[model samples]
Target: MLIAHIPGALLGLLIGNIIDRNLAIKSWADLRTRLPVRAQPQLNAEQVLFMLLGHLAKSTGRVSAAHIQSARAEMQRLQLSAAAQKRAIAAFTQGKDCALTDLRSALRSHYAADKAEQLLTAGWRIAYAQGLATAKQRRILQRCADWLNYPAASFSRLEAQLMPTRLRPNSAGNELEAALQLLGVTRSTSLAQVKQAYRRKVSVHHPDKLMGAGAPPAQLRAATEKTRALHQAYALVRKHLQG
Candidate 1:
């Protein structure tokens, strides 16, 4: 094959451009990966709560007044107004009639992972609101967590926090487990990874961002507890690293 060689400068420019293009693409990808987890803008928030609460309540096979009340508490937690509450009630009624499989499909397709996690957390509160979660409800919650593709450890952490009755007080093992889970990191994670997780979680739940997005006053209030929890968890992680 007879090769017509390009000028050295032209070849150098072509290689440089290729490298620049690759770096740009990589930087864009990194930027996207670093973006904070956020709610689903397109999904209706009240309806999502209704669907999640309804599905969770029904998962126990018999929805109790307590379960219904817990759902209401979620509305209270979200600070829904009277009209919004009525709409949520209607959605909850619809959710009660839904099959678990159908709700799972809807949740997975309609919301971002973070939004889905928020909805599922609401479900957990309802399930545990009676002071303990039933075996069936726990099973259903675990399955739903799997469907959401959340880390099992993270789910365990939330589960533990909600059901402190199940844990012995001041057990470092339990506390450490809970802390790692809250930070969304495994025990094997490095300190840098722990810090990164802490920052990411804080960014996602920042008061200004949620308030600016029209999150309810109650929800903002609830975020204070979450923030405190994050700080405690980070402290535990830091202690473990220093030790």
Candidate 2:
């Protein structure tokens, strides 16, 4: 009887141990499921720029051919690789689909001053892609600029400075008009005012100055083009005024 009782006791103890082990394993699995997952990485500045560009492109009811061309031009300017270009296109599409709240959330992270300025500049370029920005486009750009912590005054200045100059059939008049627009002056403006505007534009857009301010290489290249345009504009405008 004692021997029988011993075997039964041992069997019961073994079953209890097995049940405890199974419970322990189940608890661990449940805890794992409840634990927080690591989030995906955030978008970088270039991606964000492209996204904003797409967003601005679609602001005026629908995206136009000019907007597509402008976005392609930006992709070329950035010299994006095939993979990067694909990613940019995807981001642009996402931007077109996303709400303004999503854009605000995406831009919530802080960027360096120069970087912020560069992004804002890109946004302005896209906004003015259709020769002139529509009211909706301007409003969208203003909101984006505010989100980027870019100054409202600076945004207005950029709009004034970067607006595309329209060319007519007259070659000489076209050149003169473009030059004047680039300098932010008019044909009747005094020589002194033109000179002052030229100086101000040069000071703001000089490549060396931008580089010193920690602007990226792309911005420096753009600054170089801008500085050259300013010089040429000043030369033509100066000659026209003096002559």
Candidate 3:
């Protein structure tokens, strides 16, 4: 009823928000404890490999002997159980060749974009368990970021803050660019200007928009993660400006 008095634009927004909330709640309820018993939760195939790209980065130049072994070792540990582990490995061996999407309505029937994204975030962490995260690892992670429609820089900044030390120093520029790009601002942007830009960017990147885009599972996951990082970036930059 409140929306009835609003302008067309605002009315549409209010209605959309309600629909998204309903869908999210439904997704939460359906997936709460329904993780596949023997399967790796119904995430996209691209999501799995995109994460594998992160793991593979840990041993890029030396992807010879120990790298794959390390991935397997980590995979074994990350897998929930023996059966899941086998399936995970089988999925990994398929590598870049994995299937991405399925029949349209079938996909729509099976997963709302939000649920697909949740599964994608799960996969990214699994890819990181193998220890070493090199530049190559960052690149693969970037692709995962892209799939989730994430601003790669924002997550990298979060990673930098959480880790405190860089695996390499030179990459800071790359990371910053990623964050700034997500904010829809560039380094040339003044401090005060960034805040407005940040708010606007977050408003647009919301998972709700991704859902409206008919985002695939990977994109939904990416957007969700990016939204989080975008918030973090806004805070960090705001603090930097205040100081």
Candidate 4:
């Protein structure tokens, strides 16, 4: 009887150990999930917009009068009052000379996904305001898009919208080149190169991936569209290569 009781006691101890270990694992996971989010300093939308405008202007090598005027127009459209306009202007001036870190922080803290989208659009308008975008403007715009966390395909689509084209939207011929540009490759690009670029894009915009990276719900739709566009671009490239 004592021998039988000893085995039963050992079984009870084993069960207790298992329960304790499971509870500990759960507690650690909860602690990790509940880890506090670092608060970003609050920033004014108008000020951030102009600062970004300033940063882009410098990207093209000169903050021209036209550039400044375009920013002023955006300010007016936003209905900023005289005092607010001055503040925005001040931010723009300061931002022009500020380091890249400041610009990036402002973007991360001040703008949500939709606002970031609008800012990208505003950039094209500003660039196109003086006619066709220069090579420098295009290059700088791409860099700005990167800093703003805008996907390559989304950047291409937005930039294409402002460009003059006789072909209707969704025309295969038009999309072929745009698709190449979106993938950050050219016509002469190898299939391997295209695939690599496509995978990089997918990693950046996948929903589970973005959510894990703390992407907001508003941006999840953007991520979805980016992923779709990437698929389209890759499909076009693969078909072209096969043919």
Candidate 5:
């Protein structure tokens, strides 16, 4: 009778352990299934956007070390899970092969403009994080922004803000003047001064740089909201000055 009781006790313990592990695994699997179909391992819409943007940032054919590092930092700063971050890195390195347009369309289909803009803004920052936003990168970002319903001017403003300081304003337009003023450069400022000012201002507003400095949520929100106005103002200013 003693021997019989010991075997039954052992069997019960084994069954309990198996049940616990199975429950844990099922829970894990269910959580994963709940994630975006396109973005496995990510648990939320925000994480899906990050993964999408990370992929787009690398699509420009540059993919610098700084870009990769900055993307990782942004992921952490945004408080994304480790699994999601790894998925984002992998998806980004995969580049344009992933059909980003479909994802963008889905975002527009499912979310509001503000939410989609956040994703696009993060992508733009990631692309420019490497210190240069090439034409190819710009096009990719622009398309994404457009699909996400972000005003076209937003990209221009962000680009203007990102431009090197040495780029002198040659246009006579109000927009040009405003951009110059925004960068703290006067019409009489020397080319060198212009470059320096641009560098300083650009660095201050650079998303990756701001991320490193632990920028506040309000500031980030403001930047996104105001980017379109800035772009329009910068464009008018650049055209006028350059003419």
Candidate 6:
């Protein structure tokens, strides 16, 4: 029997190569384990908006018919397909069940400034669906605004802009104040200043402009209401000033 063997140096070199290859493979695996993972996909703006609306509706302990109606109105305005509407409902339901912190985090992750403002406007509409926002609803909405980097004052302003007409103050003094606030002016402001403010508010809240901007039907209605309020406010202010 003849036994053939490779030289010791060649065998040693082959063994070294195999060891190096194994080490390289192990290093790659270790690096992979250490690498940052891709984050879970964040919810989109519509989902977050609907979820927040759901959370807002449930904030006071029970969801009301008005809240459901408001959500449906938003869906209609969006012209969502039947499947998308179903998803919106699911997201809203999830919002009712999910933690507030989770919803806030999702909102912050998914929405930019303008879009976040629009979502917050929708939230205000939902909160005011039954005329006025309850304390719990206001707190939830304020927290959401804060999460989106909107100041508390801005939240209050937005709330004022969307306040239900039937719920607005009817007293002479309060009406005057609300008018001034709506016009972004004050009693001390000159008539010229008041006119400027009124025009500015009208331009911003005009239903035509809102519609042109692709605002939903619900938003258009809100804008129309706001415009009407602005006219009333302007007239009241002008009357008070002229007299």
lDDT of 4 by residue, 113-132 (tens): 66667877777767765557
Order of candidate numbers by TM-score, starting with the best: 6, 2, 1, 4, 5, 3
Q: What's the TM-score of every candidate structure?
A: 0.47, 0.52, 0.31, 0.46, 0.45, 0.53
Residues 1-243 of candidate 6 have per-residue lDDT tens digits of 122387778888787789667755456677577679989766877888898899999887899999999999999989999998998999999889878898767788776576667888888899988867998888887887888888777777888889877677775778888888888887899999999888987887789987667888899999889889999989999999999
169-237 in candidate 1: lDDT tens per residue? 667877998999899998889999899999999887767788778889899988877888999999999
Instruction: Give the local distance difference test score of model 3.
Output: 0.56
Q: Is candidate 2 or candidate 5 better by TM-score?
A: 2
Pairwise lDDT winner, candidates 1 and 2: 2
Best by lDDT: 6
For model 3, the stretches where C-alpha displacement exceeds 4 angstroms are: 1-66, 69-79, 96-137, 159-243
Best TM-score among the predictions, by candidate number: 6
lDDT of 3 by residue, 106-177 (tens): 233333345444333443443344444456555554554555555556656645543423333545545666
Model 5: per-residue Cα lDDT over 8-92, one tens digit each: 7798977768976776545668757656778344234654565566565656665567777767777777786777777666655
Residue 150 lDDT, candidate 5, scale 0-100: 72
TM-score for candidate 5 = 0.45
* Each prediction's number of clashing residue pairs: 0, 0, 5, 0, 16, 0
RMSD of each: 27.4, 18.4, 29.4, 26.4, 20.6, 19.0
The deviation in Å at residue 88 for candidate 2 is: 0.3
Question: Roughly what TM-score does model 2 have, to 2 decimal places?
Answer: 0.52
Residue pairs with backbone atoms closer than 3 Å in model 2 (clashes): none
- Model 2, residue 106: what's the lDDT? 64
**Candidate 6 vs. truth: CA RMSD?**
19.0
lDDT of each: 0.79, 0.80, 0.56, 0.78, 0.63, 0.85
